[model samples]
Target chain A: MASLIDLANPTRFMRLSAVLLPWLAAAAAVLLVVGFYLAWFSAPPDYQQGETVRILYVHVPAAWLAMMFYSMMALSALGTLVWRHPLADVAQKAAAPIGACFALICLVTGALWGKPMWGTYWVWDARLTSMLVLLLIYLGIIALWRVLDEPSRAGRAVAILTLIGFVNVPIIKFSVDWWNTLHQPASVFRMGGSTLDPSMLWPLLILAAGFTLFALALHMVSMRAEIMRRRVRTLTILEAERLDRLAAQGAPA
Target chain B: MNDLIAPLGPHADYILGSYAAVAVVLVGLAASILRDHAAQKKALAALEERGAGRRSGRRAS
Candidate 1:
């Protein structure tokens, strides 16, 4: 916990991230390349889905990250409410847009996949509907932050909303199982065992890892940028106040 | 996508489109992050310099 606080300190974070940035960026690039290669070439085509199944390389990972991002936001939200870490607000605010982007990718790719598989571009199946609601939650967070000028207040408000919206996450997960849905049930991560064939599993796993790392790299960069933005805003405000005082002193003295 | 793309054989517009979209968004996002960082750094530097100038003038008096 102490280590985490030290890491979260803005100056420490900036220094640490500066040292680690190149490594993370390189790892993201290398993993993405290998993952894409396997996904495109090495992985066998699905007997049922064929090449369209290749879209899973991108779709599944994005879908996973979409959920992961929301969970992260919830945790950051909690951090904001409980610890009130200065970095938490920056993290929470920085995460919103990226989470929304991942959600959008998930939705768009799901639609594209659905069109060929289910003969429809859109469906209100419980799984799809819940995911849509999740996307909306992300958007609402972004919108809330945008509307509120006060960062801490916005963080508090978002934290409450995120905690409430977290109830939808499990619903999103179980929706397909609970209903006669077009979407498939859990295949990759399951209690008994993964149903995926070895030929396909390796590529998917690599892609998933690549996506996770990529998200982390992006999040760190974004958090750093947000912290800097706040610092600059503070400096600007203080400068303006100082100028105001100087102008007053000079007036008809 | 494998279903639709495999049939297209040598030409798969949908597969191509998906890749294009992903590349564009990722690059755009990277660029935006870099630009924001640069702008913030500049603003911070300027503020620090101005603050230093004010301090020096205060010492002068």
Candidate 2:
């Protein structure tokens, strides 16, 4: 087995990702198709939400992934600030936009689910509001990365921002329980066992797994792109410096 | 086909819209990531071919 430190090397990571990318993408695609089929056909409608319950298939998974990606980023932030892992800050930067997209999807789908069930498209409920905040944080992190031109400077800034912003992750998770919100309480992850039937639960879990794989595959690709982009910058700068040295040597002393 | 997959009933529009939204966002995200990856790969390969840097074909250890 490859050592963790060895895998952290950019060349090693690139080679590994090159081999793993196709398999990961293929698995994600297959899992998503199977999960969607089960969700649409196999799972029965809820007694209360009726056909609207179908929204849960996408909504739940998107929400879960949004939070999961943030947690991943938070850990990456630690690696950036603490260990100064070469890939850590790169991974965090690469993942922000994807996390933001997931959060946006969660918000939009949740609203779509909300309108039919709750009779309104928007609400200030704890779950909904905190989730919106989470989306904003993702956008903020992405913007921070863009505004700072220096990777080293941006890495530290983003690390600090990510760690500070992580307070909202737990808020998003516990908002429903902490407040008398319109959103339903935890049913699938509670200690008393899931209230959801096996039929519904299986599809939800499968879809969640598919989304996790999809996000990871995208992250891997994004990290590769970031690494290549950095390499290009370094090469361009080095070429310019070499030309300057040759010109200086040819000039009269 | 609608009958076979359990009719979405009165809330069909919402359900379909929710799924559509997810599909669009995820597909768009995937496309953007893949496009960036391709562009970066091409740029890096071009630079390496030009021998622009002494560090080409080797990691900065």
- The estimated TM-scores of all candidates read 0.91, 0.93
Error of 1 at A189 (Å): 0.3
List, residue by residue over A1-253, the lDDT tens digit for candidate 1: 8678767898988999999988887888888899899888788878887677877788788878888888888888888899888888788888777777777777887787778778887988888888899889988888998898877888899899989988988888888788898789999888889899987888888888887888788888888888878888776676666667778889421
The C-alpha stretches of model 1 lying farther than 4 A from their native spots are: A251-253, B1-11, B52-61
lDDT of 1 by residue, B1-61 (tens): 5885566444255556666666776677777877887888888777676663353323222
Q: What are the DockQ scores of the candidates, in order? A: 0.38, 0.63
Residue A123's lDDT within candidate 1 is 86
What residue pairs clash in candidate 1, if any at all? Answer: A50-B2, A51-B1, A51-B2, A52-B1, A52-B2, A52-B3, A53-B2
Candidate 2 scores an iRMS of 2.2
True contacts kept of 2: 0.96
Measured with DockQ on alpha carbons, how good is candidate 2? 0.63
lDDT of 1 at A222: 89
